[model samples]
Target: MDAPIRKHNATDEERFWAKVDKSGDCWTWTAAKTNGYGVFRIKPRNMVAHKVSYIWAHGPVPKGYEVDHMCFNRSCVNPAHLRLLTHQENGQNRTGANTNSKSGVRGVYWAQGQWIARACIGPKTILVGRFDDLGEAERAITEWRIEHMPVSLRDRRRRVSGPLADA
Candidate 1:
């Protein structure tokens, strides 16, 4: 492995920026990653690159809070694209649907021949609403998320595909 993100002579802030690629809208980490997230190893332990970036730009992450990629790019270390969120808020902005989801949308699933809309916050799953119409189920979940999640969810459209495309 290359030298840890911090080396003896260089300041932590200076050394950290050296490995970032800022050519695009999202600044990406150019080095090592773990589970799709960039890792920066220093003396004590390995710190997430985006977390380091957020600390440098903003401040320390509050107790019990996590750093989230507002742009949905896991490798992005751009401070502008990052925000602090509670674990529950972060869970709300999942990047994609689960493998079992046929609707191609998260939180909306089919059960018992009707559509179910639910939001999972950690271990608990809250039912938003249910509808015979798939679109109505989707809309119910989406609206519930927007109103309830602590962080702002991306307002972009979700692509509905597979069996749910027509509905």
Candidate 2:
């Protein structure tokens, strides 16, 4: 196996996290996004820089894998918690209200003879509103996503080519 990300002499994970300033609401880093979700910048955005720094310091990324945010936080840079996963595996692990299921992404829970919408994310669970019907549940998800995760104008998809195709 290759050396751990900490082995790199130039960039150190511990040092990277120390440079982060979270006084602002979002953890924004100066690094450009490498391999899509992987952030890399000389300065720092929020806390994501640490994660990118760790990978950059190490070596080339392995095949068929993607770095995932274990904390489910886009801004968190805690190296100890950062993990690797396949693209498909990442989708399978979706919790809360992000899953594309008819049962509801997150808020709705079936109880007794009714469907209730309880928006729970991270460590907090908000009652938001309960839905008596499935249509109500779907409506809640649509509204929630619209208000929270609005579609980005810039495309975030990454294109990766196979090895040795330049023949």
Candidate 3:
């Protein structure tokens, strides 16, 4: 679906910033939120706050690209931390392992006495490899991310810890 055309008048800009909690690097949205991301009602449509902020500062986000929050904060409307990325790239930049993950590492799971590494791109989930060691599986997933994801999307700074710390 196409994004709503924003009316960037002085009054609209004032109304937009009124809901922002500009206390830190992340200019957090204090308005209504869905799934932790801010939601703003712009007449006929309810639009995302960050998307509105991006349009206010820059322009309409390019077609086929999503606005990714580099700081990983959904409530943030800071344009400096925002970038245009494909859906796959946006998913690759996701923070933390899934809540249901038993392995503690993202894309690594234990099954049938082996650690299986997998990577998801768009709708397709590709099996990277299977290994007896969790470290090997983690490494395989990391390699896949490095190859398929952009440098900005890769979660390289987060050191793997917990049960898989050594791994």
Model 3 per-residue lDDT tens digits across residues 1-167: 99645556747677788889999999999879999999988888999999999888889998889988888889999999888888767778877579999988889999999999988877899999999988778877876786777543445554343332345
Q: Report, for every candidate in turn, its global Cα lDDT versus the true structure.
A: 0.81, 0.50, 0.81
Q: At residue 114, give the lDDT of candidate 1.
A: 83
Q: How well is each residue in 15-132 modelled by candidate 2, as lDDT tens digits?
A: 5554454555434343344533435445544334544644755544478876666556555555554567666555434544545545744556777777766643445666656668
Cα error, candidate 3, residue 13 (Å)? 0.9
TM-score of each: 0.80, 0.37, 0.79
Residue lDDT tens for model 1, 50-83: 9999998999999999999988988999999998
Q: Name the runs in model 2 displaced over 4 angstroms.
A: 1-39, 42-51, 56-59, 98-103, 106-167
From the highest TM-score down, the ranking of the candidates is: 1, 3, 2
> What total of clashing residue pairs does each candidate reach?
0, 14, 0
Instruction: Please give the ranking of all candidate structures by lDDT, highest first, separated by commas.
Output: 3, 1, 2
Evaluated at residue 62, the lDDT of candidate 1 is: 92
- 10 residues in a row with least lDDT, candidate 2: 152-161
